[model samples]
Every structure is written in C-alpha cells, then in structure tokens.
Target: MKLLCLSNGHGEDVIAVQIIKALYQQTDQIEVVALPIVGEGIAYQKSRIPIIAPVKKMPSGGFVYMEARELWRDLQGGLVGLTLAQLKAVQRWGKQGGMILAVGDIVPLLFAWLSQTNYVFVGTAKSEYYLQDEVGWLPQTSFLQRKLGSVYLPWERCLMKNRRCLGVFPRDSLTTHQLQQFGVRAHDFGNPMMDGLFPEVPIVEEREEARSLRILLLPGSRSPEAERNWELILEAVESIIAREKKRRLCFLSAIAPSLDLNPFCERLQAQGWQQNTTNSLSTPVQDKQGLEFQKGVTRLLLTQTAYHSCLLSADLAVAMAGTATEQFVGLGKPVITFPGEGPQYTPAFAEAQTRLLGASVILVKKPSQAATVLHELFSDPDRLQLIADNGKRRMGEAGASSQIAEYLVNQI
Candidate 1:
C-alpha cells in the first residue's frame, strides 16, 4: 500500500509520521509518501518516508497588524495564495498511487474529494462550533462567527458531505458524539499525538528532585496572547507563592519560533517575578537575582521541551485553555483551565470544554481568581489527588495512537 499523509506544523507532522511508522512496523510491504500542508519546516526533512510531493514555498509578506484580532484576520487572509500550489501537489500525487490521510487541516479534505481517494480526516474539530468554542482564540473563527463564521458554514458542510471521509477524533466520547451530528462518519481512538509522553527514568541515588511540587504553566502559544498571559499568570503566581511558600512554580515557554521572548520576560520582572532562565530550553540565559515570592517560593523556567516529558514530571498544571489542557488530563494530572479574556475564552468556549470533560477538569472564570483556586487546591491535598485520579479516569489509557493508526490502516 502506498500512503500519502497530509500534515501541517511539527506537531501534526509528527503525528502523521507516527501513523506511517506504525504501518511500516506492521507490514514491510508498505510504501509511504508525505505531503506537508504548511511551511517547509524541519519535519519534512526529518520524515524517513519518501516525500514525493515536496512543500512549495508560500508567497511571503502578508502584512498582519500587531493588534491581536487584526493579526488573526491578516493571517487567515493569506490562505488563498497557497491553494494553487497545494492543489498541484495533490493532483500530481493523487494520479500516482496511494490513499490519503489528513491531519487537522482542510487540505486533505479538499484534495481527497478532488482525487477521489478514500481518506480519513482526523477530527481535531468536533464541529464548526468546536473550534469557535474551544480555540476561538486563533485567527480563525467558526461558521457561527459574525463575519467569516456563517460565510464558511455552507462551504464546510459541502466539503464534509461530498468527501465521504471518515472522521477520527481523540478518544473523547463527547467529541465523537458531536462529530456524528455533523453527518460525518466518526471514530474515537486515543489521541496519538500524546503517545510516548513519558519515558520511565530510573530513580538513582539520593538526588533531590527538582521541586517539591512541579507546576506546569502554559500561556497561549502566540505572541500577542503571550504578553497578556505572562501578566495574568504572574499575578496569580505571586498570590499562590505568598500563601504557600513550600511549593515551587515552573513555566513552560511553548511559544512559536517566529516570536521573541525578552519582552515577555521583562514584563515578568515588572510583576516582581524574576526570570528563572536556567531550566528553560527556549532561553539559555540565567538570572542571578530571582524574584522574591513568599519565603519558600522559587520559580523555574522550562524552555522549549517535549510537553509530554514535562507533564510526566509535573505534579499539577495551570494552563491557559487549549489542547495542552487535554494532554495534561491525559497524563492523569489535574489541570486548572482559565479562559482568559479574549476571543479564545469566550463564554461559548468554556461551556463546550465543560461538556467535553464532564467537569473532570477545573475552570477558572477570571485570572484574578486563579490564586484563590490554587490555594484551595493546595490546602486540600486530597482534592488535588482526586483531580489527578479523575483526570486519568476521564482521559482513558495511552495507546490511542495505535488505535487511531489501525483506523487509518482500514481506511486504505
């Protein structure tokens, strides 16, 4: 079997490879091809499979204003420029041989219909409502948004209806139900993106573990949101540290490579929280003068890292609501979700998240309230333990990747 995998960024590309790798592991007769949908990132080169359809250089310099909302619109406006390029790649490969597998992007859906290849669209978005509700913060909006939301609804419905595509979702029961409503055939396999999240590290001699309580802090991944997130989270961290001096705080900088971090770090200093750069992979500089928190409060910055490894090492996580929240829950760690002010955390988004997780996770209405919740959670260690226990129960077991891979294999 010759397979063509459609992938976007490194995360999705990694997922594409995992499925292909698993297929190869199962059968040596398998022949694979890769067709990257987004920028020509290192993931394309890192792919061991053949790249019969190489990524084309997208037209550059689509100007986006620095304002968050406007920036998002500008980014979305540029999608058309690459359509022809992507279509050509798909046409060339579709004529050759193989089935298609799309990973969280629309290109595969469009290409599959045009090429008439049996394919599966991994259901990253449960409904048009799902993205609007869960990830409204991104530049894109749902078919329900005031401007672009309704406009795209007819088009989206048409694509899904005609494609005869199978929808694959992360083994979340609620999300699978939503997909069914859209008239697309849906399947739930554990989220393979979270596979191999934790590697067992042998505990050796009496080496002091890094921190008593390793708290993972994920601000939004974009730059505009990062500034606001840094400010809001620092305030909460201050309050938490003051009340509970024994605990240590850690920040995970998962910002995209396109942006800079100094400005955000400087803002942290303004809030009386010094940069603990030593632990961050994204930033190597060390700050000698650590910010003064409550007597026992220490902050460490974890630079760019495999998030799963971080989750594996963490006791608890406070994440700005997004996909990371799900990953934290999958690791059996309780995550506190704050729908911070912005398009991302609107009232609609919060409700959808609550429904999906069945109240297994924590939702904070305001950033100001985070410290109070954290304090309450810390005060009752049993409650935190319950959260962790419940998280694993809700997220289910690992190996979702293998299950999803099997579904894709059947699609061919």
Candidate 2:
C-alpha cells in the first residue's frame, strides 16, 4: 500500500514527520510520500521523507488569514499558481489507489477530498475551546456558532462528514466530542504536538551560584521577526536587571537552525551587552555549547544545541513563537509574551494562545510591562506553580505519534 501525507505550515510538518516515523516502524510494505503546502518543509526533509509537492516560504509565514497585508504579499509571491500546482499533484497521486493523511487545516483536507482518495484528517489547527462561551472574550467566531461543528466555519464539518474520510483526529477531546455531535467520526487519541519531547537532567557542575532566576527566550524561527523579538526580549531583560540589582538573572536563548547568530550578536552589542571571551572552547561552559554574553549582573547564553534541555532548565520563558511556546508550556513551564507588529505574533495571536493554554502564558502590552510581570510572577512562587500545572493540563501528554500511526495502519 502507498500513503501520501499532506501537511501545511511548520507545526503541521513537525506533526507529519512524527506520524511518518511511526508509520515507517509499523510496516515496510507501505510507501510514503509527503506534500508540504507551506514553507520549505525543512523538518520533513531532515527526517528523509520523500517530498513530492511544490513548497515555498510565503511572506505571511503561512498565516495569510491573520492580516490582509500578508495575504496580498503572498498573492504577489505566486500563491495562486503554487497552490494550483500542489492541488494537481495531489490529484495525480490520489489515482494510485491508496491512502491520504491530511495533517493540517481545511486546505490539505480539501485537497485530499477533491482528489477522491481514502484519507484520514488530522485537524491540527482549530479547536472548540477558542469559541467556547468561557473563552468568548478571546477573539473568536460568533457566539451563535454551531457547538457541534468546527470553530471557524461549516466547510470543515462538511469535509469531516464526507464518506471518503476514513478517520478524523482532533487535537483534543473537547473538539473530538464536538465533531462527534455533528455526526462526524472524530476521535482524540492524544496530541501529537506533545510527542518526541524527552526531558534532560541539567548538569549540576555547570550551575552558577550567583544565578537566581533562569529564563528561556524563544524568538521564533522566521527571520527579521526573530531578530526583532530578540531585541525586545533583551530590552525587557535589561529593564528587569536595572530594577533588581541584588539578584543575578541568567538568560538562555534557543536559536533555531534556520537563523543566523551574527545578527543576534550585533543586536546584543547594540544593547550594550559584552560577549564573555574568557571561556575557551575546551571549557565546561563552552563544551555545553553556547555563546555567552553579560550585561551588568545578567548573563545570556545563546545556544543551538539541546534546545529542549534549555527549556527544562528554565524557571520561566519569554517566548514570541507559535509551536515552540506550546511545547514549552506542555513541559509545565509558565511563559510571558509581548505582542509584535507581525504577520504571526500579533496581539490577536497572543490572546488566542493565552486562552488555549489557560493562563499558563501571560501576554504583556510592552517590554516594560513584561519586565513588571516577570518580577511579580517570580516573587509569587504559588502563582507560578498554578500556571505550570495549568500548562500541563492544557497541552496534554506525549506518545500520541505512535498511537496515531497505529490507527492509520489499522484503518487503512
């Protein structure tokens, strides 16, 4: 049997890769091919999956719906032509008479449906929680929206109910129940988003005695925006240090593989942070692998290695990201975020994330406000604990990848 995996966006690609890995483990008889609708599908390529569709990095970062400007920019970048080509590929591939696994929102699901293929829909994007009465204040659809259908529109419900759809997996149980009420065969096995996270024990010898608070900084993977976020976060950290001179704070910045560290180093220098040149490459701190910098009593370690361990070691996180933020929260860590003038991390995005995570993530208006909140949250350990617990509850547990793969194999 042959399986064609359709995924859209960065997060979707990651989820698709995990499922692909599990699928490979299940049987060698099945051949797998992937079609990533947005971005470069770098994760899929890294995992050595056979990519068969046209892929591009749009100006909107695959979120054209978020802003009109992003949509226009993507349109100018041949979005229409690209999408049409990808649709054609799906149609040609579908004729092979196998299975299709759609790993994103309406686009991939629609493509699979149009191709007349037996498919499984893993709805990774929308959730009923966004439109629930309890979270109605957070930007959402109308209150009169169908409780038994998708949060956005009726089209998804129609697709999910289609006869060709072999299985429908939702990100959470609430969504699964909602879809089931709408007469769609939906189930929430678990969230594949939480899969592949292995916690690492921090090295005791590398711990600094003067470091009172350890904070993780995630500036996202996209360029320019990542740099901008880093600047804002560094400014906020500076403010925190200026206010509290007695306690020393350590900052760990997780650099994505796609980003260049030179710009980040320049930004740090522009902000009056000095690189610590004393530690040689052979030292323990250097062996841990990171570029170290200092500003007053605050120390910043920028690293590209052991990213998850950095998150595990942190007391809190100041993240301006999408999937990374959720992953950080899933590890039971509280996060602080400041909205950026973005095609991605806008105020609306922040509000939606806050609602999704249930107060595990706090959104601040500006850098100064972020500093204030950070100080307050650090002082209140009980509040921090509450947020951590909330995060673990909201993000769900790991091991969903293997379960999802098993379901795909059995259903197909």
Candidate 3:
C-alpha cells in the first residue's frame, strides 16, 4: 500500500510527521511519502520522510490568507506556477493508486481531493473553539459568523462529507462534533500537536526558601520573523524586570534549533544585557546549549536544546508563536501573547488564537502591557487555575498520534 501525506506550514508539517512516524510503528506494509506545500518542509526532512513532490518556499510562507498584501507578494513570487506543479505531482502519484493524509487546511485537503484518491483529513487549521469555547460563544461577532456558526465553514464540511474523503480528524472534540452534525465523518482522537511534548529532563520544584518565578519566551520558529519577535519580547522582558525589580525572575527563551543565537544575542547586547557565564542566576537546567544573559537581577537563558524543559518548567509564558504556544498551553501553562507584523503572527492571527485557546491565552495590545498582565495573573490564583484547567480541556491530552496511525493501518 502507498500513502502520500500532504501538509502546509511549519506547524502542520510537525503534526503530519508525528502521525506518519507513529504510522511507521503500526505497520511496515505501507510505503509513505510526503508533499509539503509551504516553506521547506523541514519537519518532513527531519523525520526522514521522502518528498514525493517538488516544494517551493513562497514569499508568504504559506500564510497568504493573513493579508491581501501577502497574497499579492506570493503571486509575484510564482505561487500559481508552483502550486500547479505540485498538483500535477499529486495527480501523477495518485494515478498509481494510494491513500492521502491531508494535514493543515484546505490547500492540502483540496490537493488530496483533486488527486481523485481516497484520503483522510487531519484538520489542523480551523477548530470549533475559534467560534466558541467549551462554555459559550465569544463576544463581538461578525454577521457572517452569526449565520454560519461553524468554524469549518460550509464548503469545508462538503469536502469532508464527500465519499473520497474517508475520515476527518479535527483538532478538538467540539470541531469533531460540529462536523458530525453536518454529516461529516469527523473523529475526536485528540490533537497530535499535543503528542510528544515531554520535557527533556524532569523539572524539579524549587525549595520554598529559594523559590523564584520562572517565565518562558517563545518567539516563534520561523526566521527573521522570530528575530523581530525576539526584539519585541525583549521589550516585554525589560518591562517585566522594571516592574518586578525586587523579585527574583528567571526567563527562559526557548530558541528554535534552526535559529542562529548570535543575532538574538546581539539584540540583547545592544540593550545592555551581558552574558552570565557563571550561570549563578539561573535555576538548575539540563540544556548544555543554554546561554545565560543578565541585566541586573533579571536572568534570561536563551536555550536551543531545552525547549521542552522550558515549557514544562515555566510558571507562565510570553509567546508570539503558533504550535509552540499551543503546546505550552497544552501543559496547562498560561500564555501571554501580543501581535507582530507578519505573514504569520499578525494581529488578526493573535486575536484568532485567543479565541481558539480561549482563556488559556491572555492577549494584550502591546508588549509592555505584559508586565501588568503577569502581575495581575500572579495575584489571582483562582484565575490562574481556571486558565490552566481551560488549557487542558481545550488542547486535550496527548497520545493521539498512535491512535490515528492505528486507525489508518486498519482502514488501509
């Protein structure tokens, strides 16, 4: 049996690879290949999955939907030609007969549908939480939303209901229930994004006598955008230091392995932050790649290797990321987010994320506003617990990849 997995964007690729990797464990009878529609599909490459189609990194970085300007830029960058070529490749592969696993949103899903092959969709983009959380509908709705209601939209539901699309796995239970109500074969096996997010080392609690507040910073995984986010996050860190000067604060910047640390270090150096070689200010951590920077009493550790440990150990987070932020919230840690100019983490995207994650994500208008928000959050233990509970409910528990992979093997 042959399987062609289609995914778009960095987050989607991660989710796709997790399931495909699990699929490998479930059966050796299947021959799996991939087609990443956005970026370089580094996640697939890292997973050792073969690329069955040509992929180009577009100017929009697969987030053309964020703004018309991004869409125009991608068009100028030959988005149409690249997409046509990819579609042709999918068709060529589909002609030989196989199953398609479409991850991300409509782009890959539409590609799988166009292939005229049986396919399953793991809807990573939209979730029912975008429209309404577990409690009720959010405020300030557009008339279109009031009428349409569902986040999957009408045409998307139609695609899921089609005979060729055998299974639909949405991000959350609410999304699955919504799709099923529309007669779509949606399943709520939990989100694969929540899988394999364990810490590299067991995060021990601080002794009560020497306890300090720990914060995590996620500046996204993408390049120059992450650099810019680092600057913005630094501004917030400065504010946090200013506001809480008396208290001991440890900030962990979970730098993505793909990002170069020098540029980020330069930004801090410009802001009067000096590298703390002694690691005197930081709490015990397992990352050898971690570099500690000090600006007075505030200690920031920029680590490429301790990404999961940082998330698990954090008391809270100041984030401007997609999958990383979601994963942090999945650990029942509250996230404070602000907008950035982007093809990705734009103001619109941040607003939507707050809706998707509900109370788990506290969206502020500016980076400086984070200090006040964190101050407020620390004071309200009940609210903090509520946010934690909401995060667990929204993101769901892990182990979804194996379940979905097993389902695929049985069906195939």
Candidate 4:
C-alpha cells in the first residue's frame, strides 16, 4: 500500500516523523511519502523520508493568524500558487490509490479529506481542553465555544466524521472522547510528541547538579522569529539572576540544529557572558551537552546535538514555543512562558496555551516578570506537585506512535 504523510509547521513535521518511524518498525510493505505544508520538511528528510511535493517557507513561517499583515505577506510570497501546486500533488497521489496520514490542524486535515483516499488524522492542534477540561467549559469560554460543544469546531468535526477518515488519533484521551460524542472515529492513543525524548544515554543529575537550579530554555525552532525571541529570553535570564543572585543557576539553551548558533553566541557575548571551556561544570552524565558560558554564578549551555539531553537536564523551563513547551511539560516540569513579538509566540497564542496546558504553564506579561513567577513557583512545593500531575495528564503518555502504527498495519 502507498501512504502520504501531510503535515504543517515544524512541530507537526517532527510528530509525523515519529509516527513514520514507528510505521517502519511495524511493517515494511508500505511505501511512504511526505508533504510538509510548511517549511522544507527537514525533520522528514533527516529520517530519509521522501518528499512528494514542493514545499515553501513562507514569510509568516506558518503563523499567519498571529498578525493580519503576515497573511498579506504570504500571499505576496506566492502562497496561493504554492498551495495550488500542493493540491495537485495530493490529487495525483489520490488517483494512485495512496492513503494519507494528516498530522496537524485543519490545513492538512482538509487536504487529506480532499484527497479522496482513506486518511487518518493525528489531531495535534485543537483539544477539548481548550474549550473545557474533563468536566465543563473553562471560565473564559468564548460565546462561540459555548454553542460549538467541542474545540474541534463544526467543520473540522464534519471532516473527521466522514467515512473516508479511517482513524482519528487525538493528542489526549479527553479530546478523543469529546470527538467521539460527535460521531467521529477518534481514538485515545496518547500522543506521538512524548515519544523519542529519551536519549541513548540519559543525563544523570547528582552532586553539584542537584545543588543548582536548572532551567531549560526553549525559544522556538523557527528562523528569524527564534533569533528575535532570544533577546527577550536573555533579558529574562538577567531578570532571574538579578532577583536570586545567591542561588547557583544552570540555564540550558536547547537550540534547534536548524538555527544558527553564531547569532545566539554573539548576543551572549555582548551581554557580558564569558565563554567557558573548562570541564569544571560537570553534568554528572555526558560531558555537559554543549558549549558552556558563564556570568557570575549562572552557567548557560547552548546545545544543538543533545535535544533530549537538554529537556531531561532541566527542572523547569522558560519557554516561548509550541511543541517544545508541551514536550517539557510532558516531562512533568512546570514552564514559565512569556509572549514574544512573533509570527508564533504572541499574546493570543500564549493565552490559548495556558488554557490548553492547564496548570502546567505559567503565563507572564513580559520577559522581566519570569523571575518573579519563578520565585513564587519555587515557594510552594505542594502546588508544584499538582502542576506536575496536571502536565503528565495533559500531554498524555508516550508510545502513541507505536500504537497508531500497529493499528494502521493491521487495519488500514
């Protein structure tokens, strides 16, 4: 059987890669091709997956909804033409009896449904938590939501309920149950995001590592936007150090390989951070993740090759991201998030994230306020424990990819 994987955004690409990897583990008879609606599908290519269509990196970077001007800019960047070409590609694949595995929001899901072939959806965007938790609607539920019943929205639910949709795997079971209420073929198969977070060698925290407070920094994976977010992050770091000068703080900057390190390093240097080469900052496991830098009692490590190590090494996170923040919370760690000037991490997005993640995320107005939130966060251990429990429940468990793969191999 032939299969086409359609996804949007870097996060969706990564999730699709996880499922594809699991698919290979389940069976070898199927041929797979990927169509990353956003970016160049770097994650797919890294895993040796074939690209079956032309993909473009738009000016909005797939966050056109953040600002109205971003959508206009994408149109000027040939967004319409690129979309038409992609639609043709999908139609051709459908004519060949190729099934689709859509991982993301409406864009990919709509495309998959339009393909006229059997398709499955891994709903990574909207969740029932956005409108209501396991109980009822949130306090801030909009007028539209009170009537809609589900965060899947009316038209989105319609697509999922279609007979052509072979399966629907939501990020969490609560969402699956809600979609099932609408007669959709939704499954409570955990989430693929939690998988592949374990490195070959886990970073062990002992001795000095246990003494210092560790923070994982996730600015994001997008290009220019990530570079821009770094400024606010550095300021937040300074704010954090200024308030708690006595504590030994370890900051792990989990840089994506796609981003240029020179820009980040230059910013650190300008901010009076001295590059450190000595092994004195022992990580207890593998020789610290990446290059280390120092300023006063605080140590910052920028790592590109050790993504999982960076996530595992931190006790908390200062996040301005989507999937990365969710992944951090999935580790049962609380995140202090601040809005950024973005095509991605805007105030609107951050607010929605708070609703989606529940108590796992602490949203602040500005970067400078991060330190204040951290202070309060550390003050209450009981609240911290509750946040941890809420996070693991929100992000769901790992191995969803394996389960989905097994189902597809046997059923689809």
Candidate 5:
C-alpha cells in the first residue's frame, strides 16, 4: 500500500512528519509521499520521505489571506501554476489506488476528495475555540452559522461528510465534538502538534547570591521578520534586566534552523552583549551546543539545536513564532508575545493565538510593555500556575500521531 500526505503550513509539515514517522513504524511495506503546500518540505526531506509535489515559498510566507498585498505578490510568484502542478500530482498519485492523508484545512481536504481516493482528513487549522469561548465573546456569525459550525464553514462540512473520507481527525476534542454534532466521523486522540517533544532536565547547583529566571525567546522562522523580531525581543530583554536588578535573568534564544544567526548576533552585539565562551561551557541542557553572551547581571545563550530542550527548560517564553508557541504552551509553559507589522505575526494572528491557547499566551500590544508584563507574571506565581494549567488543558496531551497511524493501518 502507498500513502500520500498533504500539508499546508510549516506547523502542518511538522505534524505530518510525526504522523508519517508513526505510519512507518506500523508497516514497512507501505510507501509514503509528502506534498507541502506552503514552504519547501525540508522536514519531510530530512526524514528521507519523497516529496512529489512542486513547492514554492510565497511572498506572504503562506499567509496570503491575511493581507491583499501578499495575495498579489504570491499571484505574481506563480501561485496558480504551483497549485495546478500540485493538484495534477495528487490526482496521479490517487489513481494508483492508495490512501491519502490530508493534513491542513479545507484546501487539502477538497484536493484529496477531488482525487477520488479514500482519504483521512486531519483538520489542523480550524478549531471551534477561535469562535466560541476564546476571548469571552462570540464571533459575529449568524445563529444558523453557529448551529452548523463556527470554524468549519458549511461547504467544508459538506465535504468532510463525504463518503470518500474514511476518517476525520481534529486537533482538539471540542472541534471533534462539533464535527460529530454535524454527523461527521471525527476523533481526537490528542493534538499531533504535542507529539515527540522530550525535554531534558538540567542539574542546578545552589546559589546563595540570587535566584535565576530562565526565559526562552522564539523570534519565529521567517526571514527578515525573524531578525526584526530578535531585535525587538532583545530590546525587551534589556528593559527586563534594567528594571529587575535583584534576580539573575538567563535568556535562551531558540534559533530556527532556516534562520541566519549572523544578523541576530550583530543585534545582540549592538545592544552591548559580549560573548562569553570560557566563562560558561555548553551543557547537555543547552543541547551541548550554543553561544553564550553576557550583559550586566543577565546571561543569554543562543542555540540552534534541540528546540524541545529550549521549551522544556524555559520557565516562560517570549515568542513571536507560530507552531513553536503552541508546542511551548502544550508543555504547560506560559508565553508572552508582541504583535509586529508583517506578512506574518500580525495583530490578528496574535489575537487568534491568544484565543486559541487561552491565557497561556499573553499578547502585549507594545514591545516596551513586554518587560513589565514578564515582571508582573513572574511576581504572581498563582497567576502563572493558572495560565500554565489553562495551557495544559487547551493543548491536550501527546500521542495522537501513534493513534492516528494505528487507525489508518487497521482501516486499510
């Protein structure tokens, strides 16, 4: 048997990787192919899975609907051509009489349905939490619309209930229940986004001088904007250290593999942070690889290895990222975010994330206010625990990928 996997965004690609890996463990006889819609399938390629569909990096960074300028830029970037080629590939693969796992929103679901193959839909994008009880208010949808569904539109729901779809997997239990209410066969074993994250605990020595607060900085994965976010986060960190002189603050910047660290290093140097190679050695907790920087009473460690370790070690995170933030919150770590002007990580995205993850991720409107927010959060342990518990409940536990793989294999 052959299985084809289709994913839309970077986060979807990562989830696809986990599910694909689980599928591999289920059977060696089956062949798997991945098709990434947004960015290049780097994660798939790294896993030695063959990527059959044509891929492109859009000017919008896969967020075309967020802004009209991005849509226009992507159109000029051969979006139509790339999409047609991908559809043709899916059609040809489906003709081989194998199963397709569509892992994204409506687009992949529709594509797989159109392919005339038995498909499993993994709805990673849409969740009822975005519309119903996220921000203590209802979205401006009609009563009929709410009765049908909030996140999944009527047309999407119709397709999801199609006979060709063998199973439907939703990211959360609420979405699963909503689909079930609509008479669709949906299940939630846990969020696949929370899978495969193992964090190593670090050994600590008693220090009588001052207590340390560890903060992980996630500046995101997109270029130029990611660099810009790093600068902004550094500015906030400087403010944090300046204001709280009593406690020793340690910052760990989790650099995405796709990002260049040169610009980030230059920004830190400009902010008067000096590299301290001999003073602090890289430990296993630091992924045994990282560059250490020191400024006043604060220390910064920059690492491009083991993102899970960074998330595990962080008491709190200052993030301008997307999937990484959700994963951090899934681990019950609270995060602080600042909205930026961009093709991604905009105010709308921040607000959506705030609603999606609940109070686990706090959105600070201004960058300058981030320091104050972090300080306030740190001072209130009860509030921190509340947000952390909310995050745990929102993201759910891991092991969804294995459950999905088992179901798919057994069904086939």
Candidate 6:
C-alpha cells in the first residue's frame, strides 16, 4: 500500500513516525509518502520512504494570514500548494500501485477528501471536540481559533462524515464516537504514537552507586513560561539541596530551536548551579529500554531525548503542567505539576491535570506551595515511594504505540 502521512507540528511528527513504523511492521510491501507542514517535516525521514513537504517554500509567519490564504486557495483550486504536495507525492507512489493513507493535519485531510482518497487522521487536527475541550498553552483569541472556528468546524464535520475517514484519540475512546456523531465511520485504536521513545536502564553511575537521591526539574519546552517555572523550581531545588545534602539535582533542559536558553543557563550558573553530567539510570529490570545521556554543553537536547533521559535517571520530577506530566505518568514516575499564573494553566486545567494522572500527579497552586511540597516529599522518602508505586499501577504497561498502529491499520 502507499501511505501518505501528514503532520503539522513536532508532536504530530512523532505520532506520524510511529504510525508509519507500525504499518510497515505489519506489511513491509507498503510504500509510505510523508507530507508535513513546512517547518515540521524532519521526523518522517527515518521511515525510509519518499517524503514531500508542501509548506517547504512558504515563509513562516502569521497563522491568520497564512491559513486564510491557504484556505481561500483550497476553495478555488480544489487543493492548496501544501495539499498539492501530498497529491503529487501520493500520485508518484501510486504509480508503483499502492493506496494512500493519512495520519495527521487537517489540510491534507481536505486534499484527501477532494481526491476521494482513503485516509486515517491521527492526533488532534480533525477532532472538533478536542478543540472545544483540550487545554493548551495558547489562548483562543491569540491563535485566531475563535475566528476560524466557523470555517474549521464545517470543513471538519464534512470530512468526518466521509466513509474513508479514520481518527486517533490520545486520552479516550472518543475518536470513533465523536466522528460517528457527524455521520462518519470511526474506530478507537490505542495510541501507538506514544511508543516513540523509551529510555534504557543505565549502568550505575558513581553518584547513584552511593545511593544518593536524584531529582529532576522540568519547566517546559518553551522559554516564555519555562524561565519563570525554572526560577521557581530552582528555588525549591536549592531548598532541597540545603536540607538533604545527599541528593543531586538535574534540570531537564528544553531547547526549542526558535528560543535560546543561554542567558537562563548563565543566570543559573551565577547561582552556583551546573548542568548534570551523570547519565540516565533506569533499574536492572528496565535496562533494555532505558535511554542514556551524552555529556555536552553545545548541542541543544531534543525535548524527547532530554525528557526520557531525565525521567529514567531521577527518583522524582517537579515539572510545569503539560505533556511532560503525561510522559512521566506513562513512565511510572510521579511528577509534581505546577501551572503558573497564565491562560494555559487555568483553574480548570489544574483540576484536569490532577484527575488525569490520578494521584501520580500533584498540582501546586502557587510557587510557595511548590517549595513546601518539594520539601515534604524530599523529607519523607516513604511518601515519595508510595506515589511512584501508585503511578506504576495507574499507567499500566507501555504498549500504546503498537495498539495505536493496529487501530489505524484496521481503519482502512
């Protein structure tokens, strides 16, 4: 079969890769073609397939301007430039005799609908319920989401009604149910994309050899909130270092290419802090799947690389509320999530964060509360261990990737 995977952001790219890999694993005879949103196209290269990017030449700028123009062109031309990229790429692979399958992004869904091609929609693009529901860092007005709601909803509903449509859900079995509400045939598949990166157990490091406690502080992947969260968490870490002399601290660095953290690192350096030199350490039982950290000051650690390494090494994590918390729970590690004063971390999200992780995630209302909680958790090892044990039970096993793949394959 010929598969056309479409992704918009870095998160979707990770999902697309897992879906493609799973499809190939089931049937090696398939040919895959990836068409990603302009700047977010690198992850699919590893699928060993012919990949094309539609937005490759488009200048990265205002979403309202770009999306409006693209949507208008699509209405007139049957497909936009990026959609044409998918069409052309799929056409090239079809010549070799295979079917086209889509993974994520709404633009490609528009093209696939126009082309009458069979496709699967993965991640969050076509799911209207998610937009109405899922909480993120962006405000509704800030991203033109409120303005584009009318255009996007109708387009999404029409696409969802198609018999060839398939959708993936991250949290619930709502994908198929929600699509069915719009007169579409859909099915729930476990989220296979979550299986992207798993850390391996590391050889016992010297610090760990002495059985010293290691803690991780994850502010986030973006600099705007990360800087503030890092400062808050650093104060808590300082308190821990002072009280518990045996423990070591590691900051899971977020290095978004669009943002720099050099100034922040320099600031931390002035406070007598240094980057972690020790590698990630998972237990003997998890040795086969743990990730190892490489020593370097120059290379910006990819979000997944840094996160997976830190989760494995540290006994516990203090993080800002977001996807990282979800990842920690999946890894059977309890994390303390604090949503700062921002639209992203509203009161509703604070509640949802706690509910989603059960007891594995603890939410802090203020920076001062954070310091108090960390101090308590550090002082009481039994309480910390109990949280970790509870996390392991609540999250279950780590096979979401394969399950998600199987669901996508069955959709076609």
Sort order, TM-score high to low: 4, 3, 5, 2, 1, 6
Superposition-based RMSD of candidate 1 using all C-alpha atoms, in angstroms: 6.9
Query: 133-234 in candidate 3: lDDT tens per residue?
Result: 666766756678858868877888788888999899988888888788889998889989899777785466778777778999999877789999999999
- The number of the candidate with the highest TM-score is 4
lDDT of 2: 0.81
- Mind giving the per-residue lDDT tens digits that candidate 1 earns over 217-304? 7775555665677677666666666666655454443443444667666765566655433432221112222221122246455344
Model 4 CA deviation exceeding 4 Å by range? 200-202, 208-210, 278-289
Superior by TM-score: candidate 2 or candidate 3: 3
Record all residue pairs in model 2 with backbone atoms less than 3 Å apart, i.e. clashing: none
Candidate 6 residue lDDT tens string, 18-46: 76777678767666676665444656665
Error of 5 at 19 (Å): 0.7
Question: Which residue pairs in candidate 4 have backbone atoms (N, alpha carbon, C) closer than 3 angstroms, thus clashing?
Answer: none
lDDT per residue for candidate 4 within 309-400, as digits (tens), equals 77887888999998889999988899998888887888889999999999999998889999999999999999899998999999999989
TM-score of 1: 0.71
Model 6: per-residue Cα lDDT at residue 176: 46
Off by over 4 Å in 6: 46-50, 56-115, 124-158, 166-170, 173-188, 200-210, 223-229, 242-261, 274-306, 340-358, 375-397, 403-412
Q: State which candidate has the highest lDDT.
A: 4
Model 5 alpha-carbon drift over 4 Å, by segment: 134-148, 200-211, 279-284
| Model 5 error, position 191 (Å) | 0.3
Question: Total clashes, candidate 5?
Answer: 0
C-alpha displacement of 379 in model 2, angstroms? 3.1
Global lDDT scores for all candidate models:
0.57, 0.81, 0.87, 0.88, 0.84, 0.53
- What digit string (tens of lDDT, one per residue) describes model 2 on residues 1-412? 8898899988899899999888889988888889999998888898888888788998888889998888999999999999999999999999988999999899999999998989999888877667652334434555566443457467788888899998888877767877887888887787889887654324333447644577888998888888888888887777777776777677878888788999999989998888888754311223255788887767788887757667767778889998889889888888989898776888889888887777788888887777788778878989988887777766666877888899888977
RMSD (Å) per prediction: 6.9, 2.8, 1.8, 1.8, 2.3, 7.9
